[model samples]
Target: MNEFKKTNIENPVVVIGGGASGMIAAWRAASLGVPTLLIEKNKKLGIKILISGGGKCNITHDGNIEDLLKSFQKNEALFLKPSVYKFNNRSILKLLEERGVETYTRDDGKIFPKSNDASDVIAALEWYLRNAGVEIRTDCSVQEIIFENNCVTGVKLNNEIIYSSNVILATGGVSYPQTGTTGDGFRFIEKTGHTIVPLRPALAPIKLSNKFPYGWGGVAIRDAELICLVNNRKTHSERGDFLFTHEGISGPTVLELSKYAAMELANNKVELILDTQPDKDATMLDSEIQQLIGLHPNKQIGNIAGLFLPNRLVNHFLNSINIDPEKECRKLIKEERKQLVKLIKEMFIGTIDTIDITKGEVSAGGISLKEVDPKTMQSRLVKGLYFCGEVLDIAGRIGGYNLQAAYSTGFTAGESAAINYKSQSTTP
Candidate 1:
């Protein structure tokens, strides 16, 4: 049991994980004049941040904090209310701005660095931690957290024991194993009397059971509704733009609804129904198609359909319903026209095969929020222990909400822990 001497403080505040939340937590703790140490198993910090938003890093969402809270579920929003309000999107942006990183918000309210580089975000965070005198230990994996009598003492590594009264576990969930987030925090906390919500994949792509032979990999559908139907009844649905992958489909809408769809896929048969023309009903679309057919009687039916649907999907759409794409509009019968209308309104994509959690942008499920104090992000079951970021069972939809959660929760935990440490140190 060797004591680590990386910091001058008698008992430094130790933070595990070097991702978004961990970095912020260490910075905040050290900023309060508390010596802090950030430990990461990987060779570098913010590996996950570098790959987020396709390397652009959607830093946070812009708008009112209340509106931003609406992006998460009711319980999650309630749990995050205090922390998020304390360190909201504006708070995070101000920190980054002070660190020499300029950012801009998209029309849809997703904020990103002006450089359009994720490395800039990481660099700013690193600069903040360094200037604040936070000691970071990379390439060091925490084997276990040492606690006795329901109080956290510190963490145990391969050959060293770092002693600290306060330990913040900001380790992320089980997603993108390549980034080093392999559910280690879940394991560490579970052994310490924390209840973990079963982990699942969030913001992941869904693989389709129906394999379309055609290469529709790059084809995109705009303003379409993707509905998850179990036994022919609608269970969940979302509306936005989605792109066709070689094996399946992925986009904002699909990624947002993936959490629900993945849950429904366990027992029931799940099918994805795409409403390509959601704005118009079958009757309205049929009338428009009839008018087009009447005006161009000599034109091929497939060519006419191209005006309504993507040209690349026209032939497949016609063939799936047993309609001849080359048939002239004048020769089309009433039944065939109705079939075209039905297919146009609700195109059957296919049943869901599986949603791989490893490919998810964020993993759902973690340490139960009920076991943690929302006001301080301290564990209710264990003294001197704290949690933040994806380690909590709160996951928001795509578009900067999750990142904002990380920053807010981390700040709350760090501030609270540092204050608690100060009070304890001065106690008689």
Candidate 2:
């Protein structure tokens, strides 16, 4: 056995996984004078944190608790209210600042380290954990949770068992399995008699059945509105920048609605409706086209359309609608103009084929929140068991909401676990 694994303390708070929530939980517990041990399967800690936001690491979002709560889904917002209120963005930023990691918020409210280095954030957390006297064991994987009579006793490894009075499961969701979040936490929680919500990919790129044309892969539509339709009924819509990929669509707008698209795809035909000219309705756009035709009767129709869209997209639209690019604007018939206007106003992009969970920014499901106390992050089913971070059924949208949730839930779980352990130890 390794030196770290051989060293064990009695009644220590054992934290499983060493991601965002796990590190914070261990830090909080140890900071409160409780013996805490954090175990990670990976060789190093915070792999996900190091790779988040293209390695810049969006640490958290900037806003009040109410605005932050509004960024999540209704059920998630309701469940996350207490944790977020306790460890708001300001509190997290302050904590990081105290450890020499300064942060800045973008105009869109996404916060990143002022140094633009994810390593800085990870280093700060690791520093806190070490300075707080939290024992961290890397390359150690927990195989099972030892529970008896509705209480967690310890975690079982391949060759040994580490006993603890309290165990906090901070393993992240099954997204980006390369980072070691291979759904191991779900198995442990399920074995411990906790409900596991069906896991799915969220904030992932949408793969379309119809691939974009050869050169259209890198083309981006600024200020476009993406609408999701199920069974020909409009279900969800979002407006933002969207990028065309060889396989499908991606960007803020597509990623935000990808979860709903994935859920609706299993039973219904899901189609993406892209409004290229989101600023103008069909009638208004047709009128504008008419005025353009009046002013430049001899100009090519494609040229006029290019003013409203990218040249490549304009050519694609003209070809899809069976219009000749060489045709003069004056020669354009009312029906052809209507078709062009319709294409501009509402273009059916393609059907979503699948959402690859590996490409997902965060997994959408995990331990059911009903089995957890949101205020304390303690398991309602098992004593001495706590759940936090992506392991729980809470996932926030892009722009640092998920990281904030991890920190908040981890904070609550760590504090509560420590206090519970202290009280148990002091009791007669």
**How high is the CA lDDT of each candidate model?**
0.90, 0.90
What does candidate 2's lDDT look like per residue over 73-92, in tens digits?
89889889998888889988
Q: Score residue 151 of candidate 2 by CA lDDT.
A: 90
TM-score list, all predictions: 0.94, 0.95
Model 1 lDDT per residue over 1-428, tens place: 56654432446689999999999999999999999999999999999999988999999999998999999999999999999989999998999999889999899999999999999999999999999999999999998888899999888888777888899998898889989998888888776778898888889988887876558987888998888899999988899997888767888888987899888888989988888888998899999999999999999999998977789989988998998899999999999999988887778888889998888989998999999999999999889999999989998988999999999999999999999999998899
Worst 10 residues of 1 by lDDT: 1-10
The regions of model 1 sitting more than 4 angstroms off are 1-10, 294-298
**Looking at model 2, which ten-residue stretch has the lowest summed lDDT?**
1-10
Question: In every candidate, how many clashes are there?
Answer: 0, 0
